[model samples]
Target: MNPAERLLEVGRYEEAERSVRESLAAYPSDAALLALLASILRARHDYPAALAAASAAVAANPRRSAGHVERAESLILLIRSREAVDAATTAVTLDPSWPGGHLVLARALVAARSLPAARDAARQGLSLAPRSVAVLLTVADVERAAGHREAALEAVQAALALDPGNAYGRWLLAMLDAERLRVRKSMRALREVARDRPAAPDIIAMTWPIRGVLSGLRRGLAVGAVAVCFLLAVGHWWWPQVDTFARYVSAVLAAVMIGFAARVLVPAGRLPWRCLRLLPRLMRSASVASLVLVIVAVGALIAFASSGWWVLAVVALGAVPVLWALGLVEMVGAGLDDPGMRPALLGLAGELREWWRTTKRELREAWTADGRRGE
Candidate 1:
């Protein structure tokens, strides 16, 4: 039993599963092994397997509170709400002192939408084990579902204070902040959680919009730069009449670039050398570039409107490149600010690479088919 418990505690689910299987092989009627296996399966979200294992455990030992609890958890996952409630209730009645029984009952009640009952069970479990973060989280969930946002936030905050490294608690807090439209605060909180769990889908989704915004800004700048340069260079040669307007646009663009570049590059003398040295010069450069591009775009628009020589074409030529530059800047800025985005960006790159490979493969297959048909 100690070995099995130790295996479970260490998250060696395979070893725990094997140990339970071996124990069941030696003692085919062992209800405890079945119950343990059910718990392990539940953790893996193999709810059907857990249900079968829990059912066997209960059949072997109807009096076992753990077996009933395990079955109730599986039933809850399976969406058998009424049956889960009954099983959870039975488990609590069988062993009122067992925290697991109350926890299971709380979960089942929550599933059944019986918020008050769920809260009671969670409170009972918390009383039995005051240090159980799981119980506290369950209570928080009940409070949140019951429209007690402040209470829910407090409960989650308490859990986090008890264990600052609690990823789930931090994530919940971030979600609460996001719901309240605290975009920057929510992002800051999620950024921390994303550091530990880079592959989390929710984190990726939340950061995506910010990433898009930054990318759009960068792309807008680059395109604007190239457009202004081309327009001024070519317009100066062909349409010397508008030379003054072109020079004004170019001057404005240069000033904007220089100002932003200086702002980004020139550190505030107030900061220590160590902090100043750590500033990302490349990001600053990109920010400067974006500002310059925006200024050039505005100047180009003003010139085009005043000169009135195919205004749409002139505006479009400047605007398209600026938009593209803005997008790139946004993508780079997001990656820089949220270091956690590195892995997600890498993953996205990998996905794109795979898609390219697949596309090539299909194209080759189609070409081969066309050649055969021609023959």
Candidate 2:
């Protein structure tokens, strides 16, 4: 591999881009350098630029499988699934022996929602280069898309075992664990990845509490609101004569709890504020709504207890469903947006299917055995 290739391999995308660009200045028609530039651009998440570079590379040499692979990857990132599949198929047709081409085809097939074909293509690449980390990662990705969590996990683990410090592999594992609700494990892995990649988008920083504290508080608040509403109903039914002084005391405690929850859960400081900028616009809006609703519910609890306003309690009760819905949206949106979380989400879906299948099979077998006994 050239110096530019080595830099790209190590995730020094900017340096690799500079190197390749310098080489391209001297050999502007160099298909290899153009493809290399495309890879660097893709790594940096500049899909448009990457696609342009890949196109240039293909124009320079249509027969070069590497150019076609880069083009396919760029198209996939752009969400042009059909075009990506076509580009990848061309690469594979040009060089059927190249594991890289097969892996690209697998990824394109995945983008096109052709899971079985994607799996076959990935397996073919793995067969060609069993020890290749890239090939293994492709297989893992295909399995994850297929909702085969165990297979995806095993493949990724193998890739990591071969190259323990592989950042992408580590990130993928973290996401895989997270999809299964292993929050602590996922957070630990994410922290390690963050340490290595400080300048990466604020997505990871935003993800910290979104996955942990926010989720916990969301569940806690939902349950707490329900319980409080139930107790209020019981009190109204059994002891209709509640003293004002006791109501005031309950209101004070509720206020304290709200203050404590805010102090602990709300992100503060310039860093957090800066990280907040990385969230999608809709997500930012949802987050604000969630925080506001949390405070509103607590405030309603205070008003209801202190002033004997039953309607305030009803308002708090009404907020629960909306709060829960917002939390669910945030969780699923984060999972879909984050590369690490996306696979985990897919894996979780697969696990759910497996669980239902197992339950159904056991039920059927039990029913059959019961029928035989009756006979």
Candidate 3:
């Protein structure tokens, strides 16, 4: 293996990039060096520049499968899924025996949403190189996208068994565990990944468990509110004359809910009031919206208890579903907000743009067809 490639594998991306560029200066048109540069650029999340490098590599040696494979990878990250599929197909055609070619083809098929084809390509790659960690990871990714979490977990575990220190494998396992609602298991694996790759952008996921706890609390609050309402109704029915006691109970319940919410929002010390101090840091509109809804719901609960207004109870109850939905939204937002996920998010945006472009083209074609038919 090249020293630069080893550096790239070990996550020394800047050093790898610098080494590749220096080597390229001596052999500017060398396909291998150009492909290596493309790989480094892709690792650094510079998809456009990576695409250019890969395209140069292909132009230098159109017959080389490695160049095509790198080109496909760059295209995939750029959200040009159809182009990526073509590039990967070319790579596979040029080197049918290469597991890397098959694996990347599987990834391209996945980007194109051809799950069955992706699975077939992934299986073909795995059969050719069962011990290859990259092949196994691609297979796992394909299975996960197909909603076969168990199969994905099995593949990931196998990959981890072969390469115990694979950070990507550990991260994938953690994500699969989290998807299965195995929170503790996910957290354990995530912490290991964090410890091993401290400077990795994936470390942002450390905040995920906190978000999960907050989301769970929101759901619990929703359910608990219903239970409290039921109990209040029962108490009122059992003793119609003692309305004061029910009002006092409602007020106490409201206060307790608010206190618990504050505690959950504040991660520091035992003081719930610390949440107020941190309020200014909640810059996201979504975060502010969630806080506002919680305040409104609590206020409505208090109003219902004090004035005996049934409308206030309805308003508070209605806020439950909204809060639950917001919790889910916030969870998704947290996952997408990470730097490591930026490339994937950019690809998603590209996919949407491509979809819109296709739609417009189809509309134009249909209009042209109608005009010819009328003539």
Candidate 4:
């Protein structure tokens, strides 16, 4: 095996960089060394340096797979997606069987939101290296982005089957279930994964808000119920002459209560719970109901405006929550179906959670050690 390949295998990236640099110094225009250095730089997220190294490698050997792949990756980091796509295409054309080339092409296609092509490239890479967890995950992501929820789930399941301890796969599955409005299942999945990997902050961050919202809504409902009962009792006793006004007030209060209830109930699927199977249908129903409410409000506003009932128009305007809920539900549904978009969205989320968990673990360890020293 080559020195560069050996260094990479052992995870000695800094040493590999120095070795490639020394080798390139002797040859002055060694394409392979330049490509290796570029790969190392890209791995380190030094996009500018990687781009320069990759450009040099391509200049020395335009036909080489590694050079093109490196250049394409750097271009992607630079957000020059169209150029990245062209470079990836060139790499694939020159080395159709190269796993790296296909991976780069797949990433570029995803960035461009060309879901079908991205899925194809990811699949091609996976076919060539069926055991590669990275390729499998990427394929799953592409499938999700393409609006194939079932396919994306299958890909994620396959990835988990291959590497059952993969935190990324488990986290992604949780997110998918949540989006589908399988609240209980989603929460359970998140809890299971998060417990095993307590270092993942993103899991807690995402889960906490949903949990809080659910709790808050429950509290609000209880408070509202009590308030309504008190108001009804007052009208029953001392406000008999004001019964007509009381009925109008009750109608308004009911509308407000219904709106609040829907807000709280509609988002219940986002929580982690045992009753998750009802999420998808609930999401669909909530979206439809919210939309209908918005439409009715719009018509009411228009009619009131025509009749100069500006006060009623202003009241109708308060129905914004229903519209927002409808939009959120629609978005959640759309995200669940597309496989190609899943990885970057879900993977990033998982990675962020992992990072947060790691940081917290380190901080806790440090704090404990400091306390021991103090004692």
Best by TM-score: 3
The TM-scores of all predictions, comma-separated, are: 0.53, 0.63, 0.67, 0.54
lDDT of 3 by residue, 21-69 (tens): 8888999999999999899988988888898999999999999999999
**What ordering of candidates by TM-score runs from best to worst?**
3, 2, 4, 1
The model with the greatest lDDT is: 2
lDDT tens digits by residue: candidate 4, 110-204: 88888889988998998898888777778877787787889888888988999988878887887777556565566667677767776433423
The candidates, ranked best first by lDDT, are 2, 3, 1, 4
The better-scoring model by lDDT among 1 and 2 is 2
Report how far residue 210 has shifted in candidate 2, in Å. Answer: 2.8
**Candidate 2: lDDT of 129?**
100
lDDT tens per residue, model 1, 295-322: 5555565555456444533553666565
What Cα-based lDDT does every candidate model obtain? 0.69, 0.78, 0.77, 0.67
User: On a 0 to 100 scale, what is the lDDT of residue 108 in model 2?
Assistant: 89
lDDT of 2 by residue, 1-375 (tens): 889999998888889999999999999999999999998998987777888999999999999999999999888877678899999999999999999999988998998999999999999999999999999988998999999999999999999999999878888887788667565666567668877778773364436544354555566656655666566666677755543443564476566665554553353323334555577665666676887887787788787776877677678778878977887787666545744344445556888999999999999999999999999
C-alpha lDDT (0 to 100) for residue 326 of candidate 3: 69
Q: Model 1 segments beyond 4 Å from truth?
A: 198-375
Using TM-score as the measure, name the better of candidate 3 and candidate 4.
3
TM-score of 3: 0.67
Residue 279 of model 4, lDDT score: 41
Question: What lDDT would candidate 2 get against the real structure?
Answer: 0.78
